[model samples]
Target: MESCDAALPYTLIGLVLRQPSPPHRGAASCPSRFLRDYASRATNTLLWICLISVTSLLCRRLARLVRLWVQGSRIPGPPSNPFLGRSKLIPGCGSLGSLTGYLAELHEKYGPIVRLWLSPTQLLVSVKDTMLIKEVLIKAEDKLPLTGRAFHLAFGRSSLFVSSFEKVQKRRESLAEYMNGRISVRANIIPSEIVECVMGRVDTIMAKGTLDCGLVSQQLAFYILGSTLFGDAFLDWPKASIYEKLLITISKDGCFWASYTIPPFWSREYWKYKHMCKRLKHLTEDIIQHCVEKYDLLSKIGHSSYKDNKDIEDEARFNDSILLDNMPSGVLLQEEMAEYLTSKEELCGNILGLMFHGCLATSSLISSILTRLALHPELQQKLYAEIIAVQEKTCKLDSDDVQKMNLLMATVYESARLLPAGPLLQRCSLEHDIYLCSGVNVPAGAIMVVPLQLVQMDSYIWGKDAGRFNPLRFLSEATDHIGTHKKYEDFEKTAFLSEPKRKAAFLPFGYGTRACIGEKFATLGISTLIASLLQNYEIKLQPGSENDPKPIMSDCLLQQLLSSPEVVFTKRSKRKTWKSKGSS
Candidate 1:
C-alpha cells in the first residue's frame, strides 16, 4: 500500500507537469483572468497600507492628547472656538490698532493673569501681575527666555535680537566694551553737531510755516542714526528719499507680519517682503564692502608709511591720520566685532537690525515727547527751563547734562511708559513648563505675553488718572499722598512721581540680562535731540490742525506706532541768546 501511494503521487505530478499542453483555450480569456487576479492583489495591498497609515496617525494624536492630560489642565481663559480659538472673537485681532483695544478689554474683563489661545495648536498666557511678571522675567529667565520663530524669520537666526540666550550673552559682552560709558562719552560729542546739521535742513522745510512733525522727526532720526552708525558713508550711499522708501517699506507691518506668520507661496505680502529683504541685503552688502575696501586701503597706506622710514613726528601724524580717517566709531566697532563673531553676514544682520530699531523707536519717542510738549505749553516751558538750567551750569550740553535735568528725564520716562516703544513683549517657554505665582502651569512651547502697555496703564497700579498724560507721576515720591488729597488739583500736582518700588511694573527697555543693550544709546540720543530742540525751537501745534496733540496709535511692524499732530517749529530768541552767551 505504501509503494502504491508513492507511485500514485509520482504519477499525479507527472500528469500535472505534462497536462499544461492541453490548457490552450482562448488566449484572451487567459489574459483577462490573469489581470483580474493581479488587480485584486494590488487593491488588497493598498487597503492594508491605507489602514496602517490611518492607524499610526490616530495613535500619535491620541498619545499627544494623553500626554497633555497627564501634564495638567490649562489656566482659566476666555471661551474659545474649536479651531479658531479666541482669535476670531477678538476684534481686529490681527490689526495693531484694534488689537491694542481688544487686549485692553481682555485685561479689564479677565483680571491680571489671563489665558488665551491664538489657534488650536498655539496657547498664550498673559500676566500683568507684578509678582508673576518678576518670576517670569527675572527668576526663571534662563529656562524661559524670549523666543519667537517669527522674529527669527524677520531678523536672521544669528541676529542678537533673535539669538539663543547663550549666544546673546556672548554678543552682549563683546558689544559692551565698545558701547560702554567711555564710548558714550565720546559719542556724546557728536550729537550736537549732527543735530545742528539736521535742524538746519529742518529749518528750510519749516520755512513754509506748516510742518509735519512726524515727517520732520523721521528725517532727523534717519540722518542722526545714519551719521552715527555709518559716519560719512551714509551721505554717499543713497539720498534720504531712497532711504525713506526703503525704511517705510521695510518697517510696514504688512511686510514683517506676513513673512512671519504666513508662507511665502501663499502670501503676496510675504513675497514682497522677501524681495525687499533681498534688496536690503544687497544694499547692506555694498555698504560693508565699501567699508572693507576703505579699511584695507587705509591699512596698506598705514603700513607703507611706517615702512618708508618716516621720522617719529611723521609717524605720530600718520597714526593720528589713520584714527581720524577710520570709519565712524560705531561702524569701526562693528568691523572689529566681525572678527570676534561668526561672519560678516551676522554683523550686517545686526547692523541692519539696530538701524531698524533705533530709527523707528527713537523717532516715535521724539514725536511723542514733542506732541506732549506742544499740547501743554506750560510743560514745554518747564522742560525748556530745565534745559536752560543744565546748560547754564555746564558750558556745554552733553549726556551728563541731560541726565541731571530731573524733569526732562521724568518727561521722557513718562512718554515711554504711556506709549512704550514695544507695547507687548512676546516670550516662549521652549525647554520646560513654567509655573506662575498664581499656580497656573503653562506647558512647554506655550507663548507668554508681558502686556507692557496694559501693565503700565493699569488704573489700580497708576491710579485713576493713568490715562492722562502727566509726567510728574514718574517723579512723585512713594510717600506722597496726592491720590487722596483734593487740594492737589492741578495736573502736575495730582500726578506725583512715585519711584517704582516694584521693578517689574515698569519695563520700557525690558528688564534683566536680555534688556535692550541700546537703552543707554537710545536714551542719550532722544534726550539730546529733545534738549536741543527745546533749546532752539518752540514747537506748537499747527494753527489749523487738531487743538490737542493726541497720540495717533497706528499699526506698526513691531510695536505701537506713535505719530504727532502737524506742528510748526518757531525758532526761539531765548535759545539764540543763550548760544551767544555761551560763545561769549
Candidate 2:
C-alpha cells in the first residue's frame, strides 16, 4: 500500500504538472477538494436560511410580548391576532354606529377595559364610570384625552381639537371667559338673537310638510353657531361657513370609518382628511386674526369718541367712564378669546361630539314623546287643554305658556328614560387601582366604564317595571329616581339649590367637571323651539308611521330621531291663530 501510494503521488503530481492538461482533466481531478468546496458553500447557505427563520420567529414573539405588556396586568379582553383583532369586526357592521353597538356587546361579554387589537397594539376600552371618566376627561384636564390618532385626521393638528398641550392649555384658559358665568351672560345675547331668527326658518321647513329630524337638527344647530358668530352673513361668508363644512366633511362615510379608528395614521385615505384638517386649522387662525383686527378698529373709534365726550355733559361723562371700565379691552380680550378658543378645543370637541352624538338621539327622543302623545291623542288634547287653561289664567299668549304643559314634560322624561342617547359612556384608565362600585380592581392603565344603558334600564334603579315608557315614571316619584345615580354630582348640586331633599336618579347629562356644560343652553333652546313650534302647529305622525321608527332597527345612529314620519302640518287645522296667553 505504501509503495502504491508513493507511485500514485508521483503519477498525480506528474499529471498535474503535465505540459497542458486537457480542459476537463485539471477541472475533473481532485474530486475530494471539489466536494469540500461545494459542501462549504452549501453549509454557508443553509446557515443563512436558518438564521433568517429564527430571526423572523423572534420578531413575531417580541411583537406579541409588547402587545401583552401594553395590555397590562388586569385588563380583560378576547384573544387577539398578531395583526388586527376585533378591529376586524368593523368591516361587518355596515355603519359607524355599529361599532358602538359592537363595543357595547363586548362590554356585556368581557366587562370594562376590554383590550382590543388594532394593528398589533392593544387599546383598552371602558364603557363609562363617573369618577374614572372624570379622571380621563376633566380631572386630569387635557393631559389624558379620550381622542386617538384617528380623530386628529378629521379635525387637524392646528385645530383646537388637535392642538398640542401647551397650545391647548393656552386656549382652554382663554375660552374659560366665554364659559364662566359673567362672560357667558354677554355670549348669551348673541345665541338668543340667533334663536329668534332661526325660528322663522323652522316655520318654512315645517311648511314643506315633510322632514327628517336629522337634517333639521343639523340645520338648526349650524344656523345657530353661524348666525351667532358672524352676525347675518354666516350663511354667505366663506370662513364662518367652515363650521358646517367641517361637520359635513367629517361626517362623511369615509371620514366616519377613518375618524373612530386609532390607527388612521396608517391609512392613505386619512392623509387627505389630514390635509383638509390643516386647512381648517389655518382658517380658524385666520378668523382669530381678522377678529382681532376688527376689535382694534372698533376700539380706536370707541376711544376717540370717548375723548371727544370726556369734557362734555356730567351724566354722559360718568356713563362714558363706566362704559370704558366695563367694556373688555380689545387687545386683552382678543388674546384671551384666542386662548379660550385654543384650550377649548375639547370644548369644541365636546360640542361637536355632543352634536354628532346628540342630533339623532335628541330627534329620536322628541319623536318618541310625540308618538306617545299620538297613541293617546286624548293626552294631546288634554295637554293642549292645559296650555289653553294656563293661557286663560294669564290671558296672554306668551312664551311662558309652555310652563303649563306638564304632561308634555312628563312624556319627554319617560321617553328619555326609555331610550337615552347612549346605553353607556366610556372612561380610560390613567393609573393602577381598583374602581369601587362594581367591586372590581382593574390594573394600572386598565379602562373602567359603566353600562349606562344597563344602569338606566336597571330594575333596581328605575323599579321593577323600568322598561315600560310610562310618563308617570317622571312624576315627582320618577324624578326621585333620576339623580340618585352614583354619577350625578352636578344634578345633585342643581337639586341641592332647588330644595332640601337631594334624591334625584340616573343623570343623563353625566357628572363632575365633565358634565354637559351646555345643559342649560340645550334646555333653554329645546324648550323654546318645542313650545313655540307647538304654539303654531299640531304634530301627528305620518300615516302608517308607527312604534319603531323603522320596523327594522336602524341601530342607535338614528334610533330616536326618526321615531315619527311626516308629522302632519296643516296650519294648525284651522284652529284660532291668536289666543289669550296660555290658551291652546
Candidate 3:
C-alpha cells in the first residue's frame, strides 16, 4: 500500500507534467528552472499539510486525555502510571475476586470513595461508605457497559443484564408481576417441591459417600432452578446436563474476556465460546418450545383476556385453580404479551438470565452455608432445632413454616454476609453526574462500584467480630436484654441506629430500584431445601476436611463457590419426616 503523503505529491507532479506542455514551446522549450520551482513548491505545500494534520491529531488526543486526568484527579486513589493506569494492581492472569480484593485494599488506603483508572479513558470509582453507597446506587441505575459487553454473547442484547434502562425497567416490571402472582398463589407448594428436589440430590451424595460437595450442590441448584423455571418438563429434557455445562463455561469465561475487552473474533478460543453461546441459546429455545407445546400455551395465551379490577378481584378467589389450570408449571403468564416481550428471543434471554443467576448464586450459597454448617456442628444443631420447632407447629413444611424459622433464615443470612454471591455491585452513570452527599461527584460513563463484601465485613459497623461467622448477629435475640426498664429504653434508643446502618451496609441481593426481584422466592426455596436436608440427615465434615479453607463466594460473572471442605451427610438418629401432598 502507498503512503497517503507520498501518493498525494506524486499525483500532483504527474498532473503538472501532463498539462499539455503549454501547447506552444512544447516539453523541450519549457525551462527546467520553472519545473524545479513548481516541484519544490508542491513538495513544500504537501510537507506543511502533513505537519499540520499530524499536530492536530496529537493535540486532540492530548486534550481528551488531559480532561480525563482532570476528572479523576479530584478523587483520592493510588497513583497510577500514565496510560497504563492500575491494570497491574490485579495480580497474574487476574480474576473478578482479585479485582474485588484489590478495590477493597484501595478503599482502605485511599478513603471509602476511591478512584481507579483501568486506562486513560476507563475510570472506576469505588464507594464503600454506607451513605455514599446508598446514594450512588439510588442515582445510577444503569449497569456498566463492560459488564453488558462481557455477557452479550451469551445473554443476548435484550437480556435484563444488558438492556437499556427503560427496556430493562419495562421487562423487569412485567417479570416481577408474573413472579409475584405465581409465588403468592403457589407459596405453600413451592417449599415442598424444593424439598423433594433436594432430597433426591442428597440421596445421590449419600450414596457416593465422599463426593465433592461443590459438584453435588451445583447439580442440586441446577435441579431446583430447572424445576422452578421449567417445572416437571425439565426433568424430561435430554440435554439438561449439556445446558448446564454450557452455562458454566460461558459464565466463567465471559468475565475474563470482558476484563480485557477481548472480542470473540480476536482470539483463537473465540470459536469455542461462540459455539457454547449458540448451543445455550438453542437449548433455551428448545425448552421454551417444549413447555409451550406441553401446555398448548400458545392457544391458551391467545385466548386469555385482560381482566379489569373487579374481574381481578373475582379471579383472586379462584387464584389457585386459575393459575394451575391456565398455566403450566415454570411457564410465565404474560398479562399482555406485546407489553411484556417483543419476541421469543426476549423471553428466552430473560429465562436464560434467570437460570444463570439463580443456579450460579443459589448453588454457591447453598454450598457455602452447608460447608459452614458442617464445620460448626453446634450451629447445625441450633438450626436443626429451629427447623424442627417450625415443623412441629405445622403438619408439613411450607412457606409459612419457613418464615417462622427465624434462626434458619438468620443462618442463611449470616452465611451470605460472609460469602456474598455478588462480591462487588457495579453501576455506571450514563446521562449525568451523580452528586453524593459527601461532595464527591461521580461523572457520567465512570464505573461506580460498591464493594459489597468489604462493607459487609467491616468491623466498625458490625462490631469487633464482623469477620467471624455468627448467625446470631442477624437474629433479634443477639441484641435482646432481659433486664430493667432502663435496659429496654436503651435498646429502644439503639434500635434505629443499627437498622438503618445495616440496611445500607448489608446488601446480599443489592440496593435501590434494581435489587433482585426473586429474593423471596429464592429464600423460600433455599430454606425448604435446608430444612428438608436437616430432617433426613445431619451434615458433617469428613475427617480432616475441617483443615480445608472455607469456600468463598466468587464474582457473579464466574462460578459462585467451589465445593470445598468435603462434607458427608449421615442420617440423623432421631428424625421426623413427612411426605409432600403428591408424594407416593
Candidate 4:
C-alpha cells in the first residue's frame, strides 16, 4: 500500500490537509484531500511555463540562422568575422591605413566585383571591370556620388567635392561658362609664363647642386597656380607654408578615418581638424576678397567685358596685356565670387573648394612626374632632346611648341597612368539601385568604389608590360614597306592614339560630364613646367638619400610618393641643334 502521508503539506496552519488515497485506517480528514489537489495543480503550471520558454528560444535562433544564410548567398566575398565583418582581414590595411593593396588582393581572390564590409552597417562594393566602370560613372550616374562623411566634414556640403548631384550639376552649369573660356585663354598664354617661373626655381636648384625635387615640384605647382589665379598677391602671401599647414591638418593621423567611421570627439586630432577648418575658411575668405578687388581694377581699366575668344591670336594679345606679374585675369574667380558674394559663407566655401581641388591634386601630379623623371636619367635626356628640337625651330617654347613634343606628352600620360592622383573614385547609389554588366547589384544606399589603379594596371587589358613604365605603348607605329610615321598630340587627346580596345583605360583627369573642368589648364601648366626644366637642366637622383630613387606610392585621398626624393640638377650648356624629321 502507498503512504498517504507523502501527499500531506509540511505546514497546515490555516486549514486541514487532505490525502488522495483510498480510505485507510488512520487516514487524515477530507481537508487533506483538498490540499493535495492544490499542490498538484501549482506544480503542473510551473512545468508548463519552463517548457514554453525553451521552445521559444530555440525557434528564434533557427530564424536568425536562416536570415544569415539568405543574405550571404546574394554576393561573393572573403570570409568575415560575424561582428567586425571583413575589416581586419585585409593585410596592412589597418596599420598602413590604405585600401589600395587590400583592394588588389580582394580582386585577385574574388574576381572583378568584390563585396566588403567596413562595419556591420557599412557595405562597400569595388569594381575593376572597365565596362562596369563606364556604366556606374556614365550611364547610371543620375545621383552625385557620395563622398564619405570625413570629406563632408572637411569640406562643407556646398563643396563640389562633397555636394549632391543635383546641386553640383547646377554649380557646374554656371561655372562651365566661365571655366571653358578662362581655361582656353589661360592655357595658351600661361604656359610661357609658367616656364619662366619653373626656370627661376631651376636656377636655384642648379646653384644648390642637390635639392629635394619633391619640394621643388610642389613649389612650382603653387607658384604656377598662384600667379595664374591670384596674380601678384600670391607672391606676397605665404603660399608654400600655408599649403603645407593645410595638408598637415587635412591629412592628420586618425582624423580622416575617425571622422568617417566613429569620430572620436575626445581625441586631440578631431579638435585639431576642427580648428584647421576654421582657419582655412578665414584664409579662403581673404583670398576671395582680393580676387574681387582685382576684378574691380580690371573693370576700371575697361577690360571686364572680355568674352571667350576662339581666335587664338586675338586671345593671346589680350591675355598678354592684362595678365601681368603672374596675376590671374580674375575673370572666372570674380564671376564665381559675384554670384555667391551676397553670402560670405558661400563665397568662402566655393573658393576653398577651388583652392584645395585645384592646387592639391595638381601638385601631387607634378611631384610624382618629377620623381619619375629624377629616377630615369635616360628618359630625361630623351625628353630634353625633344625640347631642344622644338626650341631650335620655334625660337621660343610656347604653347604650340610644347604641344608638338610627342615624347614629352607621352611621358606625362604614362606617369599619370602609373600613379594617378586620385586612386579610388567613390560614388553612392542614392537615387536607385545600380546593376553592373557583371550582374552585381548595388543597393541604393551602398557605396560604390572604382579602383582606378587596378583597372589601369590590369595585365589582361594593358598587356604584360603594363606594370612597367613604358611611354612607347602610347606611341603607335605606322609601318609601310619602306617607312614609318610617329604620331603624337596633346596628352589630354592622346586617348585616340591608343588602340581602340584600350581607349577607356586612361582616365587620370576623370570621365563623364561631371569630370574635372580644369583638366586643360592643369595639363598645360604641368607640361609647360616640365619642358622648361628639361630645357635647362639634366635631373638625376641624389647619391645618398633615405628615400628610394624609385618613388613608393602612398594613398592620402590623392596618391603621392611616400617620401620626398632628393635630386641633383646640372645646368645644360649650348648643344648642337637638330631638325625635326617628321611632324608630331
Candidate 5:
C-alpha cells in the first residue's frame, strides 16, 4: 500500500470519475463527507415540510369558501358587502318595524331567499321558508342567546323585557286559570270607570277643537291596557297621557335607539338607566303589590302549595285564588305549568312586550288604517256601508254580525298591504336542508321566514301592479277551475290546481301553523273601535293646516312608533246638523 496522503483530494475525485487511483490505505476517510450528506438531507426535508404546510393551508381556506358559496348559491340572493355581509344593506333590524322596508326592497331585488344581516351576521331572510326559520327561532336562536346587558340596553335589563320564553308561558296560564270565573264584573266595571275619568277631558278637548293625536293615542292605549291588564280603576286619561309619554320614551329608546346606549360589557347608559329603573321598579312594585293585596285574604286561605291538593277539580277551580292572591306568584306558577320558564327578567320582559305591542302596534295600525280611510273617502263609504248593513241585519252589533263584514275584512287586508304594521317578522333557522320554494333549496341548517309582505308583493308571482295598493286583486276566487295547482301560488294558498296553484294572494295574518294567536282578537278590536267611532262621528282631516302634515313613510317595515308619520284628525260636525247648500 502506498502512503500518498497528499493525493487524497485528487484520488477522491478520480475515484468518482471511475479512474484508477493510488490507494491511500494509511489515511482514514475524511469526516467532511458525512457532514455534507446530512446537510443535503436536512435541506430537502425542510423544503418538503414547507411545501406541505402551504398546500394544507390553501386547501382548508378553499374548502371554507366553497361551503359558504354553495350555501349562498341555492337561493337567488342579492349582492352582500364582503365585510359586513348583509347588515350593511339591511338598514335597521332589531328596531321595531325596520324589517318592513328592508324586506320590501329585498323582495324588489332578490326573488325570495335573500342574504340579509340582522346583527352583523349572515341571515338567510325568507318570507315563506317557515321550516328553516322555525329551526332558528324556536330551536337555535337561543344558542347564541340574549345577554342581560342587551336587555338592559333596550329596556333597563331590570325589566322583564329580557325574560325567557318558559317563564312567560307559565305566568300567563296561571293568570288565565285564576281569573276564569271571577273576572265576570272586571270587563264592565273598567270601561265605565275609564269613561268617567277620561270622557270629561275628551269633551273638553272636543270643545276646544284642537287635538294632539300622539298624546291621545298613547293615553287611550295606556288606559285600555292598564285597565284590562292591571285593573287600574281611576286612571284619568290626562295622567294616563303622562304615563304614555314615559312608555313612549322607553319604547323609542328600546326599540329604535339601542346602539346609542349599548357599551361593551357595561355602559354609561347604566347611570341613566339606574334612575329610570328605580322609578319603574317602584311603580311596578306598587302595582304588583296592589294586585297581590287585592286577593291577600284569598292567598292566606289558599296559601298551601297547589301540589298538596289531590283532587284535580279542586286544584283546577283553585286557579282563581292561586293567581289573584299573588300576581307574580300566580304568573310564575302558571308559566311553569305551560313552558317551564326560569327567568324573572323574562316575566317583566313579557309584560313590557305586552305594553309595547298594545301601545305601538295596536294604535299605529289603527292610525294607519284611519289615515288610508281619510284619504280614500270612497273606501270609507264602502266600509261604512258594510258596517251599516251588518248593524241593520243583526239589529245591533253582535259577534255573528261582526263576522259578516267581508268588505271590512278585505279593507283591513288592503290596509295591511299598503301600510303593514311591520314588513316582516323573523324566525330562526334549525333544520339541515330546507326547500325554500320550488327549484330553490338551502342547506341543512337554514333561517326561514314567512315574509308575507315580501312574498305577497312579488311582481313575478303577483303581476306588475304589485307595488300599487289594491284590495280587489286579492279577492279573486276560482271563476274557472283548471286542474293545475302550484305549491305556493297565492300568499294565502287559497286553493290548488293540478300543477300550478290557484291564485289568491295577500296573507296579512301570516303563514303556517304558528301564524299569530291574536289575529282574531286584533281584528275584532280594530273593527269594533272603528265601527263604534265612525257610527258616532265622521272623521276628517284638518283643513288649512300650517304644516304639510304629510307622513314620513318608512322604507323599512318596522319603524319606531314615534317616527310613525303623524296625521291630523278633525272630527266632522254632526251629520244631522249640516244644512243643504241651497236650503240654507
Candidate 6:
C-alpha cells in the first residue's frame, strides 16, 4: 500500500504523458493538454521533494549513530553488531538476572568500565568499579529516558521518583524535610509498631506451620508502611487485600514495561499497564478518603489525645491541613509542608510512590535477610544471643535498642550486600556529557548503570569470603575481637574493604545525591522487626525445602532471593540454646 501511494504521483505523470496528442485543430483538446501537462509537472516536483527530505533525514541519523558508535568503541567492551549494536548480545527484554549477568561477564572479560550498546540509538555504560561508580553517581542525576517514561506512565509526571532534574531536587528537599521531622519526633512509636506488625505475622506463621517467605515479608512491609501512612485505621481496612494485589500487579507490570523500554501505545501490555494505573489511583484515593473520614470524628469531638505522649503529639498535629492526623509523624510532616504539594494529583502520586517504593524494597530486603538467617541456623543463634543481651538491658526493644545491637546492624548490611533489593543503580546523562576521571566521558543521553550486585560481591574488594554471609565482615577487627560495642558506629571502619574503597564498595541504599531518602527508617524498621521476631520465635527453613542461599539477579525492583524459600517459626524457649554468651 505504501509503495502504491508512492507510485501514485509517478503513475499520474506516466498516464498524462501516454495520453494521445490532442488534435491540432481542436480548441477543446488544447485546454485538455494544458491541464494534464500542469498536473504532471506539479506531481513530479512534489515526489522529488519528499524523496530528498527523507534521504536527508536518514543520512543525518546514520551519521549520528556512527559517531556514537565510534565514541563508544574507544572504551573496551564486547564487539557489537553493525546496525543492531549489542542488542543481540545483551538481552533488552530479558530478566534482570540476564542483563546483570551479561554485564558482569563484560566487566570480567574487559574491565570495570565497559561500554554497552543497548541498541543503535541507546548507549549504556556499565561501571562496576567502586571508584568509577562513585564518580558516575555523583555526576548523573536524571533517570534513563525510557525508564523515566515508564515510571511516569505508572505514576504521574509529577511523581517524586520520576521527574525533571529541577523538579526532582525540589521534591527531594521537600521529602527530606518530611522524613527528618517524622524520624525525629515519631522515632519512639515506629519500633513498637514494627514489632506489633511482625508479631501479628508470627501468629499467622505459627498457626500455618509454614509460609512463603516472600508473602510474609511482603505483608510485614505493607502493614508497617500502611500503619505509618494511614495510621491504625489501615490495619482494619477491608479493601487492604485488594490494594496490595493491585500494587503487586502494578509493580510487576511496571518492571516488565521498564525492561521492554518502549512498548507501543497500541500494545496489549501497554494498555493493561495504563488500566492498572487507573485502578491503582482510584484505590489509593479511596484509602486516603477512608482515613480522612475515620479521623473526622476525632477532629469533631476535640479529643486530641489517643494513647500516650506520642499519641498526644499526633493529635495536636491533626490541626494542620492534612486530614489524617492519626498518621503521626510522616503525615504530619506532609501536612506541615502543604506548600510543597501543589495539587491533589501530585500528592496522590507521591503517596503511591511512597507505598510502591517503600513496600517493595523493604519487603525484598526482609525476605532476603530471613532466607539467609534460616539457611544458616548458626548465624540465627548468634544473632539471637545478641538480641537476648539487648533485651536484658532494655524493658522493650526499640530504635535505641536496635542501635546497641552491632551484629544485627552488620547482618542487615551483609544481607543487603549479598542480595541488594535494587541490584542495579541506574542513572542517565540526559542533557550533558558526564566527564569522569582518566579521560572517560559518558556521552549525552547515555544510560549509566552501576551493577551493585557485582560490585558488592566482588572478591577483590570484600575478600575471598565475599559470597559468604559473614556479618562480621562489616565490623572492624577491634569490634570482632572485643565482641560487642556500646554503639554500632564505635568501629573506626565498618567495611571489610580498606581505605577509600570501603564506603563506596557497599551501596545497598545507593550513593550520591539520589540515594534513597528512607535509608534510616528502612534500617530501623527492618532491624527492629528482625529483633522482635528473634525475641519471640526461632526462624527455620521448612522441612524438605531447598536451602540454596544464592540470589537470583533480575531487572525488576526486587531481586529474586532465596528461590521461594518457605520458613517455619519456632517459638523460643526459656532455656539457653548455646553454651557461649553470644556464640552459636
> What TM-score does candidate 3 get on C-alpha atoms?
0.76
- Compose the digit string of candidate 4's lDDT tens values, residues 1-584: 55555545544543343434577765656456757776777788888998989989988765644444444336677777435745475656632246867888778888877777666545667878776777777644443332335545665545354435654675576565555555545544455455556567666776867687666776677667666655545554545468546744564432354445566788786687778877777776566456546545654444434434335434433443322212233343335434444555654556555665676667777777777787666677777767876777764445556667776776777777877767676666565667666776676545677777777777776676667666656654311111212222322333322332256767676666556777766776678778767766677777886544444545555445436777777777956432222212
Error of 3 at 26 (Å): 18
lDDT at 185, model 3: 38
Question: Candidate 3: lDDT of 51?
Answer: 100
- Candidate 5, 465-557: lDDT as tens digits: 665544444343422212222222231333221211133344454433333434554555455555555554454554542222333345343
Predicted structure with the largest TM-score when compared to the true one: 6
- Model 3 lDDT vs. the true structure? 0.68
Residue-level error in angstroms, candidate 6, position 338: 3.9
Q: lDDT of candidate 1?
A: 0.62
Give each prediction's root-mean-square deviation over alpha carbons.
8.2, 12.5, 8.2, 13.4, 14.8, 8.9
Better of 1 and 6 by TM-score: 6
Task: Answer with 2 or 3, whichever has the higher TM-score.
Answer: 3
Off by over 4 Å in 6: 1-66, 85-87, 90-97, 184-187, 194-209, 255-273, 299-342, 478-502, 555-559, 573-584
Span of ten consecutive residues with least summed lDDT in model 5: 575-584
Q: What is the TM-score of each candidate against the true structure?
A: 0.74, 0.57, 0.76, 0.71, 0.60, 0.77
Worst 10 residues of 3 by lDDT: 482-491
Off by over 4 Å in 4: 1-73, 79-82, 91-98, 139-152, 155-159, 173-177, 195-210, 236-240, 251-272, 298-317, 320-341, 395-398, 478-502, 545-559, 574-584
Question: What's model 2's TM-score?
Answer: 0.57
Q: Which tens-of-lDDT digit does each residue in 126-156 have in candidate 3?
A: 9998888888888888887766777676667
| CA displacement after TM-score superposition, residue 473 of candidate 4 (Å) | 0.9
lDDT by candidate, in order shown: 0.62, 0.46, 0.68, 0.60, 0.48, 0.70
Cα distance off (Å), candidate 3, residue 484: 20
Considering every candidate listed, which one attains the maximal lDDT? 6
What shift in Å separates residue 116 of candidate 6 from its native position after superposition? 1.8
**lDDT value for model 4:** 0.60
Model 1, span 136-205: residue lDDT tens: 7653344233233443444444546552465466666656555564334434444565567777767787
